[model samples]
Target: MRRLLFIIIGLLSLVACKTDKTSVPQDFECFNQPHIYIKYKQPINGYTVKVMWLQNGEVGNALFCLEKQEVQYYYFTEKWTDKILYDKGNTYPNNTVIELDYTTKLKSEEYLSDDSPFFFSDVDFDGKEEFIINRYKSGSRESNAYDVYNVTPYGYFIQKTEAPFTELENGQCKFDSENKTITIYGSNGWNNIINKTYQLKDEKFELIK
Candidate 1:
């Protein structure tokens, strides 16, 4: 009976200790105001986690959490730093290379001085995630901030070979990370709306009717 009880206890301990994946809500300094959301990893066992939410009376800007020293840390700022080496707004203390995706629109040659929110996923479905920069503005935010990127093996961010959307207006996007699909809805005109869906294929966005 003693040996049987010990075996049962060991099985229970394994059940309690197993962690395939974990989801948690983390608060970060967004737009100098506090924001919260259920941010999860794309593949759950993947290399990165992303946080994007609505702020400034709209949806844009994002926070990225990096795992280092057996603890998680986030990179967020009330202001955009002009540090040349600190591209993508993620500046860590030990100069660790946190993988950041750069999209075609927000490439290294382009200069966007304003603070931005971002979206990340394996939009290309190449087993790697990409990023899109979101903008905040006074009167309204335009839909032109849909720059996307894929991460190079060397850790440099390169823009996507093709764009996800040909045009964009004021709107929000829903990313289906599981299926690798992106659906966007935007106000096209006074009363019309633009609804489009794109799937990742051959490293390009294939529009779905």
Candidate 2:
């Protein structure tokens, strides 16, 4: 009887462990819903500029801001230096400035000059925004790379790409609401590329050749 009771207790423990592993919480729901339209505001040049979030997609405005002082100096000196001052007011009118401390995973204290424009857009229709970030390497021109992020409603970048690449150049992206298509065209290498249309519904890119 003692051995039978011990075996029953062990079986009960195993069953409990299996239940714990497979149980789903009451409030758990899959996060696959489409995003609604949203807007954000920031202080620019003593006034406020309103930036709107993309609807049914990911990707927002390009962020243009003064790099933090220590970071700016590091980029120029190539050595880690703490001697620098950050000027906030010396910025272009149409340029959008965002705080690196707020959005990115990188530590703000390590870098130098940070005054590069980070381009971002909703290239994929996945209701999440992607970033074109600028990084100051040791000896290269300030590098531009692409990143993706799942942002919150309060303008915070949540999940981001682990690695980013610098393949595409800067250009304007326009979406056709009527046909659910996107048109991207600008500079590619030395020549001016034009009229590259992407059909959103079909997920195909057609280059006018």
Candidate 3:
């Protein structure tokens, strides 16, 4: 009887652990993270290959990646910013190359799809296309949340802050150009397929029926 009791307790423990991983409250906010914006995209090889970066604000370091490898790092400060002396010895939009430290290269499985990094849509019906960027590595069962970015009607990027934006944990989202909404579909948990619709309100996404 003691052996049977031990086995039952073990099973119960596993179930509780799994519930912790899979459980998400109905009103939980998904994109509650700090705003990280892709600052630049420049081609290193051909059009198919390029370099890009994302920075938090005027404080955090900028993460630069070539292909799937993080090849450089930069801090967002006047000291470092002033060191960017020239725009390739030219002008703005051309890009100023800066010295950067090399970071570890990503393995083969670390790469996302070719077009996976960017999704463009006008979720607010403002006639301006908003870009949604994600770092979802291909073939991974997890790592399925969003890196939300919505550009302004003028030309500034803004982060979307709202609750229940899709299932948040496992929802794979797509922008519906026709309806001006973001449709996310995935499993809530335990083989339950969940679908959600969201529309932009005051620039952030809000859940809608």
Best-matching candidate per TM-score: 1
Among all windows of ten consecutive residues in candidate 3, which has the lowest summed lDDT?
A: 74-83
Instruction: Evaluate all candidate structures by whole-model CA lDDT and list the values in order.
Output: 0.41, 0.31, 0.37
lDDT of 3 at 148: 43
Please list all clashing residue pairs in model 1, or write none if there are none: 61-117, 61-118, 62-117, 62-118, 102-149, 103-148, 103-149, 104-148, 104-159
Residue-level lDDT of model 1, residues 146-201, one tens digit each, is 44555555443455435454232224555565676777676567789776788776
Give the winner by TM-score: 1 or 3. Answer: 1
Q: Which candidate is the best by lDDT?
A: 1
lDDT of 2 by residue, 1-209 (tens): 43344345434333333343354445532121111211123332222222211112112221122222222100001111111102232222222333222222233331212333233445445544453343222222323223333434444343342211112322244555456555654455567655556554454444332
Give the range of the ten consecutive residues with the poorest summed lDDT in model 1.
Answer: 77-86
Model 1 ranges off by over 4 Å: 1-121, 138-146, 165-171
Give the runs in model 2 whose Cα sits over 4 Å from its true position: 1-100, 103-121, 129-145, 149-168, 187-193, 203-209
Q: Candidate 2 versus the native: TM-score?
A: 0.27
Ranking by lDDT: 1, 3, 2
